[model samples]
Target: MKVDRGLLEKINFDKGNGLVPVVVQDVETRDVLMVAYANREAVEKTVETGYAHYFSRSRNELWMKGKTSGYIQKVKKILIDCDEDTLLYLVEQTGVACHTGNWSCFYRTLAEGDGNEIL
Candidate 1:
């Protein structure tokens, strides 16, 4: 689902203090890559550029993924959750998605669900 600029109107940025969580996934592998925050401008830039851009809470500025690292993520689709508060970005990852040189940021596992676990 490629998003148009109009889709931005449906996002609930106010809920997250003018930011929204974006879950990035590998379009080919369907693997979760990274999670980042985005403000309205970031989202607009993403839609305009066809690349992943995010708002850095720590830096207090907008950043385009891979701008410095060259591990760019080419966005294929943008999906909004039912609540229109969160977003999922499916992208074609150029290289490792993690700054630690890992394929994904979620490499550590604190707990795993067993097959018999209840909901």
Candidate 2:
């Protein structure tokens, strides 16, 4: 889907101190890849480039996924939550989504199952 650049204005960035949480999911598998934050500029860049761009809270800057690791996330659709305070990104993931070489950042189970099992 073509993202409307004007959608940026609807995001409630101020609710999160100039950033909104973005949930990244695999388009086909429906597996949630990761959760990141995006500021206005990051969201705009993602819309402009058709790739996932997030604001790194630690780095304090905008960064495109896979800019160095070659695990780029090609955004297929962007959805805003009911309150417009959060975002969901359906994407085509190129490689492992986690830096630890896991398919997803949520590999480990935290509930009643084996904690080491990859979900």
Candidate 3:
């Protein structure tokens, strides 16, 4: 079956670059784990394998999550933002999500009010 490109038309790539932002979150715990990018091949790879894959703009190559570290992010549900420019992946993550040994990529705490601050 052919995948629909129309479904992902709202994603914003960087300056003609092929990458789009993808946010990974824990499906059960509702905690954001990390953020990555999906190029056309990466998106197709993720859909086909049910695992998260991303195109690293910095490294200029495709990278599968947790390939070496074994901290894989399995896709549970993927949600696109209203603008279609961003992706929210409700995933089943194994072990740590970040390479830094943290549960989430968003690990820093900034000065903000009690429960509403996101970091």
Candidate 4:
């Protein structure tokens, strides 16, 4: 699916520092890769470039996936929830999604007894 400026403008970005949370997932495996935030400009850039772009709160700038690490996330589809406050990015990710070099950011599993198991 394609996104346009019109659609992006409709999103309810009224919550949380003028940024919307986006869940990034793998298209084939259906595994959640990571979560990030995108401001209006980031969304625009993502659609325009056909790649994932996010607003880095820490660095205070716009960043595209794989810019430094070469872990590009090619957006397959962008889904919006009913509230339009959240987004889901279905992407074909290249290399590791996590900066820690894991396949996904959700690499730890919580078991009954164990605190956290690193997968």
TM-scores of the candidates in the order shown: 0.91, 0.89, 0.84, 0.87
lDDT of 1 at 7: 65
Report the C-alpha lDDT of model 1 over 1-119, residue by residue, as the tens digit: 35665667989996647999999999999999999999999999999899999999999999999999999999999999999999999999999999999999999999989889997
**Cα-based lDDT for every prediction:** 0.92, 0.91, 0.83, 0.90
C-alpha RMSD of each candidate structure in angstroms: 1.8, 4.2, 3.3, 4.4
Model 3 / residue 1 / CA error / Å:
12
Stretches > 4 Å off in candidate 3: 1-6, 9-12, 114-119
Best by TM-score: 1
The candidates, ranked best first by lDDT, are 1, 2, 4, 3
User: Which TM-score value belongs to model 3?
Assistant: 0.84
Q: Please identify which of the two predictions, 1 or 3, would achieve the higher TM-score against the true structure.
A: 1
1 against 3, candidate with superior lDDT: 1
- Give the Cα error of residue 90 in candidate 4, in Å: 0.3
Query: What's model 1's TM-score?
Result: 0.91
Backbone clashes in model 4, listed as residue pairs: none
Candidate 2 to truth, TM: 0.89
Error of 2 at 119 (Å): 19
lDDT of 4 at 49: 92
**Candidates 3 and 4: which is better by TM-score?**
4
Q: Candidate 4 on 15-78: residue-level lDDT in tens?
A: 6588999999999999999999999899888988989999998998999999989999999999
